[model samples]
Target: MKAYSKLTREELQTLVHELKKEYSRYQSMEMSLDMSRGKPCKEQLDLSMGLMDSLNSDADMCCEDGTDCRNYGVLGGIDEAKVLLSDMMENNPANIIIYGNSSLNVMYDSISRSMTHGVMGNTPWCRLDKVKWLCPVPGYDRHFGITEYFGIEMINVPMTPTGPDMDIVERLVREDESIKGIWCVPKYSNPQGYSYNDETVRRFARLRPAAKDFRIYWDNAYGIHHLYDKNQDYLIEILAECKRAGNPDLVYKFASTSKITFPGSGIAALATSSNNLDDIRNQMKHQTIGYDKVNQLRHVRFFGDIHGMVEHMRKHAEIIRPKFEIVEEIFSKNLGGLGIGGWTKPNGGYFISFETMEGCAKAVVDKCKKAGVKLTGAGATYPYGKDPKDSNIRVAPTYPPIDDLKTAAQLFTLCVKLVSAEKLLAERTGEAPEKAEAQA
Candidate 1:
């Protein structure tokens, strides 16, 4: 396949014509396929059905510390749960606070707590004239959504395979007193699946942000989601590194069994310094008597220990690893050397970051939707739903069945070619494709 940019105008026109025909055939199928979200399919979810039986009427329902699972007293969490999640989070049990099912909920509340009461007795963010957040591009959209909801101005930091551009991140946080925080998915990151290298993590720990209350919102959502046993990505433990750097309160690290077990019904947790935990606990005491202890106990009993949890993730990798491979294969076959686009082949994580030629992502997405396939919106991976180059689309392959995903992936590539060819043809002829055709 020729690079679309190198093709003569006639070559592009012919390719576009054939691609439109292929697309039309797909449209005629009347399919209602979705690749919009990174959700586990039924087969993957069934792997954890043992969780349902982890607790039963015959069960003792008491944790290792003799706390009744039915009780409301453990405001932070049961001790056993902290140990299990601490192992998963790679931090001390003392630093862990077990939340309910959603890590996103925990993150939202963290921001809200800062807004109403402020972090560790600083002035409330609401009282400040402006609060800014640094968002790494080709990053998680929900992270952006959280900051935007709080009315914090978000600045874009470009992402490399190693991680976000550290030079830009350090400079912005150092000089801007208004910069309150940065959202990080350091390990097996959301869209790109690129883990932060050692230097990046070290620099994050050593950052000298202007705001005393500045924090790194480190959401290690896919920390254990490895696609291969031998070839896994390792992330340096952020909390420990921060503590060693004498910046004990510099990060609020979060992780969950959301993807590991059930999507919304699994347990979540936060790991951070004693000072930060104390500050959070003060607000949490008013929030609730406790979260679901029975659920926590069930999870602990189900996974038994961190070793059991790691083995369980292997089962998950078996199911979704092929899905990731299929998408990568199709992308390679359809658009590999065309120079119209490129996509990430992640080792693990839920999404693939696809970069289209400048100004063509939205068009490709629109084309896919019209052909009965839905995708994560173009520019969604960036802050404020805006991709400055108008490139970068997120491909979620886990939700659909393998067959449906194959169809969707094929249509996606077709749309990419169709859109890219049109854009190239328009540039070559000095007009839009349709206008140029009419003139011809």
Candidate 2:
């Protein structure tokens, strides 16, 4: 029950030996389990089977405005689908533009458009001498990837429990014209599952940026993915908040039903001011005549309204809640008060972010992999796949079944303990050599 940091060398050695034995037993079982990606389990996906049934040969294929669902004319999206997504996104229907399946693809296109042309007729980003973005640390890698692909310099900003450090964000955005945007998962952020508090949201909305074109790329991916019905994290609507702060065109919000219905077949949308939407539509019209209206109709008919969507998400929560609980319980039973590691207990989201000792994350993940248990790689949560402290690890318990998740969680704890002990021992014994010694 003692904290690992407080344990003497002799005690650590004994603890490490016991953990090694347990790890060896797990390895002998040849258990192959994965806690890598935040994907829906079979049962969760099964619940959405009604989506496929919503549209059949017998169903009507017409929108409220009498647009044929099989048509190629609705450039943004069909009217009903836009209404459904607007309510889901918590934005005005007029400001929502429905896209294809992946919100990520929508994000990529936004950056691509800005690079080639410009955002609202500003100079193209590619034509700038230097462009930079503010990346909150322990953030989503894919968001970072998009910026890195554009060769934009990404500066790391620390994330507090409330949100990304806003004092830093405000200063940087105001001081540097090249700092164009920040990638934010404001509600139930990818790994930590923490939503931006009200004050954080307000600060973000009121930011006085040096660049006229600077925007907040708010990806509200898990807005309704709550794990508990009674307990949930709420985020202020950023678009509205920006409007109130006299910065109506300062943000581009994104959402998708990827987790709600089906990932590859769901509807994605961008909610923003009328000005921003108009700018996006100008480029979007050239890209495609329309997105998949049939799929949009299927989603709308299946969910009917935001209330129906919420009820369905409750069903999803019922399936994945226990898996998240299992991960939390394992962490509590194994590492609580030991100080070897710390993890998040999220209200609603697909991941649990774990932080090992400053330098032990890579070893912990590698140890798990060696024992036939797969985990999200070390440094995966940060930009350029580099966690400066090399401490954060994202645990995704949704993809695997309960039994497999249990095994994976157990193996994960063992790896955490083993690696932490080894790290502590090395630090105690001064075994780590200096960089000069390594070069020699």
Candidate 3:
């Protein structure tokens, strides 16, 4: 119950010895648990088994517009699918383009297209001398990975509870012509589960970017993923807000049914201004005849409308809610008021972001791994796998069962305490003057 930082060197040493004994017993169990990826558990995935039965060999293959889904003609998507996904994406069907199963793939291709050809007749990014993107810290690693792969220079913008710092964002974008894009999770953001409030969204829409081709890569991946029905967070629709700000082409929004139905077999979509969609279509036409309309049709038939999708997400919430609570409960019981670490209690989303004492994240993660618990690498939440403070660690509790997650969370807290004690003892004995100065 005592704060680890207040403990004397002798007390810390005694505590570490006691924890080591507890950890030794845990090691004897030889558990092989993984809390690395934000994946749906098998029970949650089972909720979408009905999708397989939605289409069959004997089923009709014609779309709502009478285009044969079995053929390759609908470049954007089938009519019914557009309607379904439009509702899911919170945009007009006319402004939406349904892609294949992966939103990440759509995101990658979008950047690739911009790099090779350019956006709306701008110079191709490949031809430019410098291209940059603003990335929010403690964001989705995959989002950072995509931008990093394109060799785009990424600048870290600090994320507040409401959203990323808007003052810095506004200033940078207005002054820097090479800052072409920003990556945003917008609603129920990855790792932190923080959503952009209306004011933040408005500020985002009103940004005066120096680059004419600037865009916001808005990945609304967890827009509808709420853990509590009553205590839910809302995010303003960026595309609509941009239009209201007289910047209709300032943002591109992405969504997918990957979490709703199947991870790799669901439908993905992009919503943007008509002009941006047109520009994308020009490049899309050359890429292929069309994306998989069959899977789109399957998704449409399975979730008839936005309401149906919402109802289904409630089922996923039921399955993962307990797992999330278990982790929170363990953290609260073990690490509360410890002055060693802190973690977010997200309303919805797949991850809990833990902030360890400065420079202690890698040690905590390494301690966890040595005890047979696999976590997302400590620095993964930042751009280039480098958490400058080495203090943020992402905890994904959704993929494992509740019992397993409880154990994992317990192990995680033990690591936090152990590492914190070591850090505190080192500071107390003047063994780490540089770290002490860094803290000061």
Best by lDDT: 1
User: What is the clash count for each candidate, in the order shown?
Assistant: 0, 0, 0
TM-score for all models, in order of appearance: 0.98, 0.97, 0.97
Residue-by-residue lDDT tens digits, candidate 1, 61-162: 988778897977899999999999999999899999998999999999999999999999999999999999999988899999999998999999999999
- Model 2 residue pairs with clashes: none
What candidate 2 gets wrong by more than 4 Å, as runs, is: 432-440
Better of 1 and 2 by lDDT: 1
lDDT against true structure, model 3: 0.89
Model 1: residues >4 Å from true position, as ranges? 437-440
Compose the digit string of candidate 2's lDDT tens values, residues 330-416: 999988998888999999989999999898898889888988988888998888898989899999999998888898998888888
- lDDT for 409 (candidate 3): 88
Give the root-mean-square deviation of each candidate in angstroms: 1.1, 2.8, 2.7
- lDDT, residue 102, candidate 2: 97
| Cα misplacement distance, residue 97 of candidate 3 (Å) | 0.3
